[model samples]
Target: MTGIRSGSLVAAVLSLGLLAGCGGGSGNQPESFENFTAEEIYKRGEYELENTRKPKDAVKYFTEVERLYPYSEWAKRALIMQAYSHHRARDYEEARGAAQRFIDTYPGDEDAAYAKYLLALSYYDQIDEIGRDQGLTFQALQSLREVIEQYPDTEYARSAILKFDLAFDHLAAKEMEIGRYYLKRGHYTAAINRFRVVVEEFQTTTHTPEALMRLVEAYLALGLNDQAQTAGAILGHNFRSSPFYQDAYAQLRGHGLQPEARGDSWLTRVYRQVIQGKWL
Candidate 1:
């Protein structure tokens, strides 16, 4: 959510106006935007975006441009600006609607990639903390994947890839939070289920090591020594350097058990996958 540079946007609008051989408007120009030309209205939007620093006001001008001059180049540009202005104003639903309209109306436009990225940001930016609903995180991942898959050569795709990883990691973090909650409440089976999801579905995330360690703790608490040892064995094999692995090792040793794949349980399957380099 970087702020748009006022100077750069103003310069770009000025260049567009000069190229079109049109003036923005004199001081005597009508207060109503209906009397302004497309370029004039667009320039006014840029002015509000930059000088006035009121993105909601900028959205009004941009939306008017699209309404007054539909199918025109200025209208297309204004639509993208509408998306940006709504985003800048922190109106995520409006930003998503504007971005989606741009994508549907001008799919092949050069700014389409930016529209897609903006759509993704509308979801990704809402994933502010792990405690929030995970639905937004899922939506962000889906939209980000669209950007990466659809515009792989663009800079937006590179940025999407980074954000995608963060959002994915955020999912794992949420699982860890819930698993920790269950474990603290002596709900070992419930904690194990949550930790298992991290180990199996989110292994690439940074939370995997901690999940494996938690699996060891939960299984041991349930008198499932074989599963606990298998979990510790997996943790040691893949994340030996992690403090979580050290903790898992100490927990196993305290129970007079060694970290090894000792049963045909889920952790054993995970351990086998780790041995074959199929699991992280």
Candidate 2:
């Protein structure tokens, strides 16, 4: 998962120190924190994060600011930083909780966009590779979509858009990965199902050309010449110069068929949309 930026985190950490509110309680552990003002505790969290590079320790102080001065604006600011600290420490669940609470309690706050973005990042960052469960990628897409739609004018929205695209592509890559695995295992039907997902739903992704090519291979293996030709036709229609298209063309020729969409297959619909501009 992506951690909070040290520069932004430090700036946010220091900014809250400008606010006013003191902490006091004899029973509180760490006598310094007990006596420090809310801003001071928040500052300590910043120091821990920036100077000490100890985000786990930083989270402690930021959490304390909210607990001790829950009503202060510093508390609100600290809550977001607390989320950042948890994220930097790789405590994704805690980061998500703190960020979600910030959004819930301060929906109209300027930092709400950042909080929501952080919540999305919590999931996005977890989607490391194609092997990971796609559930996190789906969650990231939903959260990022909310950010893009809800706060379009914000900087966070712009970043969310980029991340959303990357996550979407990642999902397609996962499908390609599984399809390739099944294809190598000689499971043509299973492989075709996986490749079809990329070709249909993830058509805009970079994986689409390769997915179409894989469909050609899988269908040919299953003795489905019409489906194979249709897949090759779609690949050639949109990605003619691509290596995948070249490969599909070569494979179709081996079967004494040419690349042309001539069946009521899923690829034929894509050919209509992409080639004939007939999308509904």
Candidate 3:
């Protein structure tokens, strides 16, 4: 009875193995993906972009579709999708290259404007803070300006204007940063030029107050007492509540020059008088 039971078990195992082999050898199995037409492929790529959670994987399929149908409409759609996927992946260099290629190849295409916008955005996204290297910031500003100049009627131009404003402040801040360095090193003249640039070009920026304050210090260091007082009066008038105004007032008092209590500072009065030859 024991020998008969063991032989029956071995037969059952062999039958199961044969069935598994037959299942593995099935030749009529369906393909993983359907062989889609060009329009179908383009539609599928759009679907993948909008519906799929895994953008990187979607990019792989889109790129494959592009390579397979270079002359078809599907290929153009796939290229644009591939560039967006690279951007979503934070692969900025790849995105930039893809966008540039699209702009070069399809200048008259409707998507060309979007491609140019993306290329500029890729550069803008890499801007460093004001205290660091501003090479990327400068490039971003240039690219964004190009978009604004070339596509003034597009939505991208409006967005570029906002970005340009931000970049302008950052550039102004960088100049102020260098000015502060010059101030710390006692290179007051060099610092004055940088601060002047901020006042002239970035008048609406937050750095304007600091630049004005630094200008006062620069004039004082140069022994131009009348100019120092004029700068201080402007600082006080424009930024009445600023701590810099109090500091400037103290500096003038320390030099035995009384700050004007009413309209303008005494130095401003003197400067006008000197310019009008009233003091002579």
Candidate 4:
């Protein structure tokens, strides 16, 4: 009986092997292109990204080429492609690092300027609207400044200057936004300080006239009538054609103050006398 059982087990094992052979289950298949060169790997990656539109899959291949052939020309191409893949994926932090790496590693290379440009673009694309946190906007502005200063002859530098102007305008707008908040809350002193900053520091920006107008309003609210009149005069002189000048003039007149062109107001003269402990 034991010999009969052992014979049945042996037949079962033999039948399983026969089925595996019939199913073409070869554990040792011949390798094709298993020893591909670094150039071949880079070409495959570039083809995947350009032709197949598979940037995500191509990233892995490009990274592998870069890692395996760091000294080869193909490796340099792969590094750039890898950075582009990160940019296309909207992974801005990684994209920024990769682009910076390329610029640092190949400063004399023809593509160095392009790599710096991509680094700036990575930050620029991350900027949010005026109402949101402006951390990214500030970062974008800094990156663009670097591009303009370091690569002044590059096409990227021209575009960076334009973008930097817009960024400065946006930052000025943020200061105005905060000043308006203070004005609405009747924190006249704080509002005046912020508006003054915009008018004096960011005077070249588009928001300068608006900021000067806010300063006049804030001074009037604080009962600093002399300051309000001075602000109105400055506004009228600098922005003679601005609608804000007309509004500021109206505000001064509404406060029962005459528009005297050259002399100090009676109230200002009186206040100065009082502060100096003089009465006439």
Number of the top lDDT candidate: 1
Model 2 spans with C-alpha error above 4 angstroms: 1-32, 278-280
- The TM-score that candidate 3 achieves is 0.70
lDDT of 4 by residue, 95-176 (tens): 8888888887888888887788888888888766777787878888888999899899989899999988888888888889
Better of 2 and 3 by TM-score: 2
Ranking, TM-score, top scorer first = 1, 2, 4, 3
**Residue 255 lDDT, candidate 3, scale 0-100:** 80
**TM-score versus the correct structure, for each prediction:** 0.89, 0.87, 0.70, 0.74
Q: lDDT, candidate 4, residue 128?
A: 65
Which of candidates 1 and 4 reaches a greater TM-score?
1
In model 4, which residue pairs have backbone atoms overlapping below 3 Å? Answer: none
Candidates ranked by lDDT, best first?
1, 2, 4, 3
Predicted structure 4: lDDT: 0.74
Give per-residue CA lDDT, model 1, range 145-228, as digits (tens): 999999999999999999999999999999999999999999999999999999889999999999999999999999999999
Candidate 1 weakest ten by summed lDDT: 19-28
Root-mean-square deviation of each candidate, in angstroms?
6.7, 7.4, 13.0, 15.5
Query: Which candidate has the highest TM-score of all?
Result: 1
Q: Cα lDDT of all candidates, in order?
A: 0.90, 0.86, 0.73, 0.74
State residue 100's C-alpha deviation in candidate 2, in Å.
Answer: 0.9
Q: lDDT tens digits, residues 1-280, model 3?
A: 9999999878655543443232234462323223444454454445556766555655655766676678577778778777887887777888888888888877888888788888888888887666778887888889899889988999999999999888889999999999999999999889988987886677778777688778778877887776676767667666769887778778878787643322354446644554565532
Query: Which lDDT value does model 4 have at 272?
Result: 50
User: How far out, in Å, is residue 172 in model 4?
Assistant: 0.9
